[model samples]
Target: MAQAGEQAVGIDFGTSTSLLAVGSGVGPVDIAPLGRTTRSFPSIAGYQQGNLLVGEAAENLPIAQVIRSVKRAITDCSETMEISDEHGTRRVDVDEVIVALLAEIGTRAKAAGRPLDTREQVRLGCPAMWDGAQRQRLLDHAQNAGLPVAHSTLIDEPIAAGVAWVRHRYLQYGEQVEGRLLVFDMGGGTLDIAVLDVVGGPHPEISVLSALGVQLAGDRLDTAIAGEITEELAGQGIRLDGLPEAKTVEALVLREARTAKIQLTTQARHRIVFRGLARTQLPILTYTREQLEECFRPQMDQAIGLVWAALRAAKLTELGGHAPDKLRGMNGDRLAADIDYVLLAGGMSRVPYVERRIGELFPNAMIYDAAGVAADELIVAGLADPVGYDRLNLHRPGFDFVLEYTESGRKITEKIYPAYTPFYSPEEAWTNSYLGFERRGDDFPGPKRGEGVLRVRSTSGDYLALRYDGETKHGLRLQLGWNMLFKIYCDGQILITDGARQTRKLRVHQWPVVRGNGHAELVLQRVDDAPPVPSTAWYLEKEYAPPGL
Candidate 1:
């Protein structure tokens, strides 16, 4: 129960897990998962015989009626929300399901000694493509959970992953921003690909150029792999049979198979035994890493293609002007047109094939193995930025920031430079070039022809700097079907684009910002001033634009 006037904490309510951190002590500390000071909490909630079980309790239940993939339901509105209880079945609101899990964890934090009545501001992370509707639902849910959100904001997933990765890299290495940093987060619900240039200083700076994100992540890949495995076994005449439901066996077997696949990262192979599998004799099966890779090789290759596409989107010229800084860090891979450095992070990145494939894909790329920086992801990232819980009290309105967003989905869509995604150092927080827009619910300011789109982003990264990255999955040759989305600055009077034109006015829209899960929508904002800003000293470049903008 945080009291009024208290600074809010940082909560990473991930799809597969829930993590809580306070800006107190030295750096943000992850409240214990099951005990005091724990870092990771299993993302499972269950409704049982007249009781709600969460975390370990729900995880250990026989056959476990716990809800595991609740996040998926949030995005798929047509899907029903139901959970099996010991006595029978129960249907619940999707938001309430999440609230139950949140309350469970919040209670754990309180029990673990986190002082009550001390959180005021809240910073949340969402997918880059999360429509305005999904964001609104999230806000509403947070309120119902009793989490007061003053100075509330949404952080892109890749940017949040960028923050977790950059911080870990700096803490592992030295002080100055290290070489070109690219954080590839293939999480449960979405895949966020970001590249950044970390600047040098006592604190550090991160400049992000682009982040190509989509709803394809580890779980989705797991499902595909499981299907392939089933197909392979079926081809051998080992059919799942005699089960209560044939589909259930495949689904449960697939889930277990994926767990084993992840385990194979360290173990040569993993085997599971499902007493009720279709094939009685082969009810227990074993799988090797090579086997798993073989089943999902095509998808992995597609992932690599996306990575290369991201590099091409960056459009970094080898010219003397701005060679990719061999050592820099930030959100979105804006430092290089071609990835010479691949920084793999997140829980799923443990797959050896991920590292192996990255090396194979980019013959010239350097991959930094941060010892699978997943368990201590955020804590180890606590280094670079010295300001932890102490700065929570200030509540500074102006945090020096450069914003980037897709005006239209195209080659440039992947490279919108944001200030919050990558880990960075301390920097000033005023701006003359900075134009502002309010993202309340679905309301947003739209762009007009000749008026470039300007994305207003909150300053949330540990470091400060700007870099852009991009990728053309559909290819620019198919430009006829592409709607150009430029990431630029709005100095008020004229919109900005780093392209052939820098001055333009975006048309304001009265519609609404996006609120759906897989859709992206933006409403045009009204501009009162002809020329915007009182002028926060511009320390970085005057303008930032995505590749081929």
Candidate 2:
């Protein structure tokens, strides 16, 4: 529960479950639980009879009608899926399902006593690998769902987890831990890994060095283990047949396998007994922790491969002064000697085998066991600012600003913010264009305002348009004619004459706009009667201001 004044709510809408956390500007972040289940809520929605239900209330619905893992569905860029129920079959877009789920969460949160009335104060977490279009679609859906998220921004899943990890350490130790960290987040449906550099202080600073994600996780593990159970049952007298019957049996096996997976964390073996699956009796089944580990071995190997790949990409594997011959069979302990902590987040981290493998890899570093960050409330905690949390000082942007126009009667596209440029604050100054690998030196100009000029030359055409392939806040158009020269200054203040001199409310694009690529393109051509008012111009320059001002 949150104390009254201007509460900042952070929602971890997971694939299998969701959680909400609330905090004021300068206090400890509190977990807002759903009913009596502490902080966890089933990330499921169902339509039964004439009523729609979500979270725990919707968990027991028929599989055909229940929408689960809608986050992953939307991330796949899917449009819709047809589901039949008492209301008949109809197509529902992934976005619509996500909206419904979020709306339900909103209602539940309010009823639970954490008011998220201010849109700007809410932070939502998204997958790390999502592109610009996906991020925008989510925002659009959230808005349409009637979520007041005026100041809402998307956070990378792993980054959010890292933020929580650091905060917990700070509160417990009263000392800021400074060093690099490798965040491994293995949830029910997805695994996201990111390397972040943490700087502890009264105001902590976290920088994401690199990240990677995979679609396979606990769901796949559960299926693989369930397959083994079904094979054993098929060997006996009882066996499931037909689509409907098989699905029912499959669902039951999955549920049991999931339970076994959790039980294997503590006990040596777990029994999988099903009596009425598909209306058939089954012999009691038992699986040991070793067998369950075997089921997840392949996925664990994949997770290892991803971790190695990320470390290699981040250059952590480079033994600067060591001999080349010694690098032959380098393991994680040697490769990540500089990393102070290996933090684990997500429910799957609770598995003893999973922890053992991660421990083997980071033998030299203290691995944060993720008991404190299991629900991923850290992302919103990181967004909280006792000083100025709502301001765009935190949170990474997920889009690349692309400058596109026509040249020689052919369209050309240029990537302004190259992918290699590390995540930076919106107010950070730009030096040497921050050209990713093309950077000449290691000097990074600190936080300061920056400006760039776009020279529009009318070589042979009179039509030019500026476009960004990602979501935009607002667009601005200005024209400089011979008689009345339209002068745009480095400062964001615009001096436009509609009829009188007045400054209209302007919305620059989303936060942390890449400063090096901060310029707009347009065409300079004479029109027959260009209006002197703000409208009717050749083209305009669009800029992104720091959000939540």
Give me the candidate number with maximum lDDT. Answer: 2
Error of 1 at 205 (Å): 2.5
Per residue, candidate 1 scores C-alpha lDDT tens digits across 372-395 of 245325422332122321211110
Over 4 Å off in model 2, which ranges?
Answer: 1-7, 49-51, 81-92, 150-152, 242-244, 275-278, 316-334, 371-399, 404-549
Q: Candidates' lDDT values, in order?
A: 0.47, 0.57
Candidate 1 stretches with Cα past 4 Å from truth are 1-9, 22-31, 35-38, 61-64, 75-79, 82-92, 115-122, 150-153, 168-173, 232-238, 245-248, 275-282, 312-341, 363-366, 371-549
Per-model TM-score on C-alpha atoms: 0.62, 0.69
lDDT of 2: 0.57
Residue 440 in candidate 2 has what lDDT? 9
**Residue 24 in candidate 2, Cα distance off native in Å:** 2.9
